[model samples]
Target: MFWDHRLTQICKENENLSKYSTYEIGGLARFVAKPRRTEDIVLLLDQAQSSGMQTVMFGMGSNLLLPDHPDPETIYISMRDHIEVMPRGDLLYVSAGTPLSMLSLFGDLSGFTDFHFTFLLPGTLGGGVYMNAKYFDNVMCDYLDTVYYIDLDAPGRGIQSIHVDDCQFAYKQSIFQHQPWFITGADLKLKTTGAAFDFERINDYLNQPLVKESIDNSSLASFYRFYRSYLSSLEQGNKPVPEAMMNVVLDRTGKNHFDYPSCGSVFKNDYTIGTPVGKLVESVGLKGTARGNAMISPVHGNVIQNRGGAKAVDVIELIKIVQEALHKSFNFVPEPELVIVK
Candidate 1:
């Protein structure tokens, strides 16, 4: 209980886990800490190490499944509020907690286009870098110059960094996954470092009531509305939205991404098979399948949705069903892209 008083300022007890995950399907969690600083993370990790307490960290809860019955003794740490952005000469120093979508917005307003691919993408930058989050040919590792992180297995060492090339980034994979490291921040290469950039504009946008509310809301529909309206406002103000960004909106909306509560994709595509997982699921006639309150999305075969009050168990059951059916039909079981936290 040595750290209890300090943690009281940032931690919540018996919080609803559904509000933290995109799937909106978890039961109550005993302890959830929203750490806004790197020092806070270190302290929490240190305490856990000394006391033999279990701990887990997540960002934005965009691609995760929290347990229906969480371990009461475990402490869940959320890195969503640790946002920080600083422009250093030609490079931008972005904290891991910064939203990946914020980079897209910053690029648009600061006269850069390379980050347009990330527009409306969910999750924080740390999670993006960890999984090498991608949009078409563009990936988080593409523009990264250097990444900084803490080794959770050895928190006594403090922060360390690695160059982008040394990160071993691949399709939906990164060295972060192979090591027990906590991403703190990174420096990104800029297309044009000489231009005068007003980064405070991004801060202003983030501070708006609607933007703040949307950032906290786990509802996919609300998330879509905020970004869509924000982009329209930019257009009305004589700032033309990029065609690439518009195309992203069209693609995601056309696929009904915001129509339901679900993780965007359930399985990673095995490119060697020469068939997408969604099409495979559809071929197996499991696209609209349901188990309890969870249903395989009728619109997107790779997505499992929460109809209303789905439980983590329901989603797990459906995953099993998909794996068995796919293995029987295709001779290979597909791997899941979504992270199911125990």
Candidate 2:
């Protein structure tokens, strides 16, 4: 009952989980909390622990498959509003809830092209760090200096920091995936030469009506439109738009990433298998396969899309089909990249 006094202000009952996820497929959740600060998160943890409730935390829901029926006894925490960005000497401290795409915008404005790879990348910084989210040859941990986290099993220990070198980052894998530590934020080492990093300008961009509206809705189409239009505006103004950044636009759009409701990729590529997961799906002739309204994207074999009103069960069926087919053909089931909330 720790949250009893502030229940109305801090949490919701019988909320639709769909509105919080890019997939937009979850059923109603019994309890949901949107925490805007580290203190709020700690407090929520206290409430959950005291009440003997399980806790589920996520940001943006870009790479998640929330259950159709979440446990009524669980406390679901959405970290989307817990955003903060601060400059510390040669490093930038970015909070976990900050969108990964925003870093690409910062790079565009500040003349640092390092973050260009993240352009149009879905998900929040925390999730990116959790999975070591990658694009082409670039990976998230490459730009990080230190990561700050709170041990879920030991909340009284408060915040802890870890050097990037010790994070055990690999292709789409990070130490955070194996630990119960909750990422709070990270310090990104800045490029020495760039048009001076303007914190206010970056905040101004995030405050834009379109940007706020797009991010809050959890609609991939809206997210894509805002970033694409912003980039196009820069192009029209004759500002230098990196070729790499433009290629990202073409690649994602060409694949029709935002055209439907779905998590980006269902399975991680198994490099040891000598074939990308998409190709394997294609080879098995599973492209465009559907279970209910969820279908394997005809264009991108690795992507499963919600054609319309797809349920979590529909997507899960497609996932199982792919896993079973691939295992039969290749003798190894591909590991799923999509985090299915049980």
Candidate 3:
């Protein structure tokens, strides 16, 4: 009853959460608040904070692996449509709700001429900036000039802006990830890769029969391309291969677990540990492993798939199996990167 009626302006109670995430698992959110304006968001946050309900924010839901039914008392926020982008002279102003792909596409379409949108955004700009989302070698913070964030409790500052340096950006992490604040937007002073590639041409190229034949999602050809790049990275003294990526072995043997619904990668590519997490799972031979309807992807050791009607507990059980196996074999415990909530 803490939220009571204060959030009536911009909140919907018991909105189903399953459709919001890319993983497409989860129960209803007690309150799925979509505040169109800053004040609306503040008021909703205040209602939740004052009532002591747990809160979680999500964007595009590309990185989340939520439960079949989350806690009914918690508040879920979706900022996907709350904000927009703007062009102010040299700066490309980005709002948190803006999808990364939108921003990049805008940059390309706007002929920002000098700036080439390089990062492959799998989700929203807010999530990307929060985690300093990375693709291959590029990162979210690399082109950022300034970031604007809202500290829910700080009404006097309205929204505060921090320079790129002070934003504390690191590999796959940002200050926002640690700090208690919501990123509102940012100012990006971008650099271009002169003579930007024609996106339409690229799209046309992708539509080519040869290219389409080369990339069979059904057959895992795309996965193989990624795996090849990953292996090439290691061979050419490039960075270590991403553990969650489907293995080249699977590609060579024509194996793909993509038939089932999956959350792609389940764990982060942590190198501080001795062996890679995926390798540890592979070492213990947990690939193609199953728990209820949730199964560890056979082709990609780090992936966990939902084989229809899978419960969150099933995935949790599979994760525990991998963790336990790794611990038993290599004495290492892998950290889950999925945004799983009870």
Candidate 4:
């Protein structure tokens, strides 16, 4: 009865959790909360602690999977869509709630060039910094200055600010992943060249038909060369990669990912393995393999797709099959990147 007063102020019980994930394949979460204010988050955490309820916080649910059967006693917190952006001098102070899409655009609009690397990622700043999200050579930690958190493991429930260190990172790993702290915001350091590109013209040029690859078969080289030169000039003058260019990267990499309900990549890249697990999966001919509605993608071996009406158990089973095949055929052991929320 006591918990009802505090918790019910921001949480809803027996939520359909499938709606919250990119995979769209989760069962009901016992309770779900989206706290718009920082104080609301503190209060929720406090009440959960007092009531002895286990709470899990996630950003966009892009890289997570729920358990086959979840405990109803658990509580889920989503910081996605709770966006706020503020500038401190030449750097940026981003709320964990800010979505990556908005964050990247904000930087471009504000004439910050280096911040464009995260322009097309699928989650919020909370998950971005927590996981140290990366694209190409740039990772969140590369620009991260400090992380702000509520110390659940510490006495007095302290809000701590910690700088990034080498121990806090690995290939798709972070300290927050193993700890009980909740990240609320981050301070990032990025350099800008000063704003000078005429983005309106860039936008118009991007919308033209000649920009399409098929439009200039013989002169494709010239078009691309000019485009590259333009982008280089903008970047040198302190401007982001054009939105159209980022769109190209997005379109190129997003292949078959949005085709169905599935986490983008089921397995993490192992540095020592020397080969991408996707290529290995293909070599073993496990594509299009199925366990119920869940199956390994024919288009991409690393992806496990929910063909339709897939269950968590179905995906879990498929993962086991792939794992077994990898170990047996290639003597390679695979590790999951997804957070299975059982």
Candidate 5:
């Protein structure tokens, strides 16, 4: 293959696509290439485009679902090896493939504590930037000074630099997300503090008893559902409720020993409903519901998991069922967080 000779490492006819993803469920890739350098990536893209092969660029594969039956015409490009980082004054030029968790650790070690939240996330820099990914409303776009991307549609395969404002960032979306632009790197503007930021204190805060224990146990996946449930109760004027609903969901779901597969929250919150979707899910009996190797996380109705050997179709089916149920019950449609590869 062209990639074999041109790139540092390239695998053809690989069937272990599931291992690369957090969900741990996927079919084979006809071609999976990992270029050692950025230039090699451009070369590979050019070759793929010319050959009329469909390409999917992936970072850490945190938020994607590959079909159970592989697409023979498609090639998967792994950007993990293209990791690069350069500190230019107060800004850091980071390759899209860099893991957010690693970046967080880097910041902590380098005494850049202001950006510690980036580390706790389970995504890559490119994916984060693309989604304007955020926690607590502190989004990636807020720190991005500029972004460098490859235009797949242009003649001669042009590269473009986008300013922060031009990205059109919003809740879990960016302009680059819908286009054929392949993110190369990002310029992250960070702040420095006079006193060294206390990594221990921050770690303690992140590892709070309630939050840490909930996430540590898989059964507690329903913690979000409980949170939504409690919020709903509050809205409904319910008083004297148990204070540990969140903890219960977390502890119960964490004990599940099924296949460690997930698409995170398979549904997005519907804003028009004026009430959180989690509350609606709890109202129905979908929480902790299970079907052939697939279950609507009893902890959280929105999260679906593969008990073991669950197919992408199965997850999709559960999502559809949930959407229909919600629509029938509350006249609302829940959006999926997982992007299905058709």
Candidate 6:
């Protein structure tokens, strides 16, 4: 039993975590905490440490896969509602819970134009920072001025702020990956634009209809589509073919409903494979292949989708099967993009 009576509105027992993630697939968390203030989070951490309890922090839950039956010993920290933002001239200090979509809207409304590219992404500022989320030739690290994070190894536990350069960001990774620090907030440096950035192209992409009757139902949006098209174009004499191909794929795959409960791209591209894995999978006619409700999307081989009521194990098993087949056929193992909660 937790004795911290001060945490009246911040705690929950056996909280269902499925509703929090994009995949909507996870077991209950033994304990869930939603502290209003940063100090409260520190105090909660202190108490959990004293009690020998392990802690995990989650934002909007976009790119995670939790176990079907999660370990009851774990504590989940939901920072969804603790969001707070303060503007400082060309910069904005933002708390971890602030969603990227909301931040992008704030930027647009406030005349800060650089963040417009992030308007369509489903992620929190913290997770964006962690993954260095990028699109339209810009990344989260490009606008970051500083980061404030909890120091798990401090002799006297507390939060510390570090400059952007110190974060050491690179392709979907950061220094925080090796350290035990938890991001609490960040400072974003923005610039004002005289003209409003046009989102007509993005809106057009989003408005496309899903190909419901297609044999390959796996669909992709944003980066996956961009990357796949880039590779396909390179294969075709490096001409401007990808631009046309993207439109074709987008038209065939329903735009708005593709990412309903997906773990995003189930695998990362392996450059050593020499050939794009999607083409390889397509060549083998594995597109639209299904394993107990988990299907290799026909729209894009890199994507795997949950048809209905698909279990985490089912997704994992399908991933394994795909990996094995791809490796045996092509002699290269694919890396998974989704982070599995074991």
lDDT of 5 by residue, 39-111 (tens): 7778777877777877777776667777787677777876766666666665678788776655554554445
lDDT of each: 0.85, 0.88, 0.65, 0.70, 0.66, 0.68
| Tens-digit per-residue lDDT, 246-304, candidate 4 | 56455634566566767778998786888888888999999999998998999788999
Backbone clashes for every candidate come to 0, 0, 3, 0, 12, 4
Give the TM-score of each candidate: 0.95, 0.96, 0.74, 0.81, 0.78, 0.77
Residue 156 CA displacement from its true place in model 6, Å: 4.9
Q: What order do you get sorting by lDDT, best first?
A: 2, 1, 4, 6, 5, 3
Q: Write the per-residue lDDT of candidate 6 for residues 1-342, one digit (tens) a residue.
A: 566887666888887777666667778787878776788788888877777777877776766776778777777877766566665555677888776655554554444457756654666788888888866467889989899999765514687888999998986788887888889899887555453323343333323342111101112244234434433644686543333334534543453334546765567666566766667777767778888777777777766677777778878887887788887887777787677887
Q: Which whole-number lDDT from 0 to 100 does residue 342 have in model 2?
A: 87
Error of 3 at 140 (Å): 0.9
Please estimate how well model 1 matches the true structure, expressed as its whole-model Cα lDDT.
Answer: 0.85
Ranking by TM-score: 2, 1, 4, 5, 6, 3
Query: Whose lDDT is greatest here?
Result: 2
Selected candidate, larger TM-score, 1 vs 3: 1
Writing each residue's lDDT as its tens digit, candidate 2 over 1-342 gives 454565456788999999899998888999988877877777778668778989999999999989889999898888888888888887889989888998998887777788988999989999999999899888999899999998889776778999999999999999999999999899987545654567778888878887766666678988898888877897899987788878999999999999998899889998889989999999999999999999999999999998988998999899999999999998979899999998
List the candidate 6 regions with Cα displacement exceeding 4 Å: 154-156, 191-259, 271-280
Where does model 2 exceed 4 Å of error?
4-8, 191-196
Per-residue CA lDDT of model 3 for 1-342, tens digit only, reads 644565576677777776666555677677777766666666667667677777787776667777676787788887765654555566767677665644543443444433223222345678788878765556778778889887866534457888999978886778887788888788866666553334444345334464334322212224334435424655588644333233324432453433555555688777777665767788788988998888888777888877777777888898888888887877778888776776
- What residue runs in model 5 are displaced by over 4 Å at the alpha carbon? 192-259
Off by over 4 Å in 4: 1-7, 154-156, 193-244, 247-254
Error of 4 at 326 (Å): 1.0
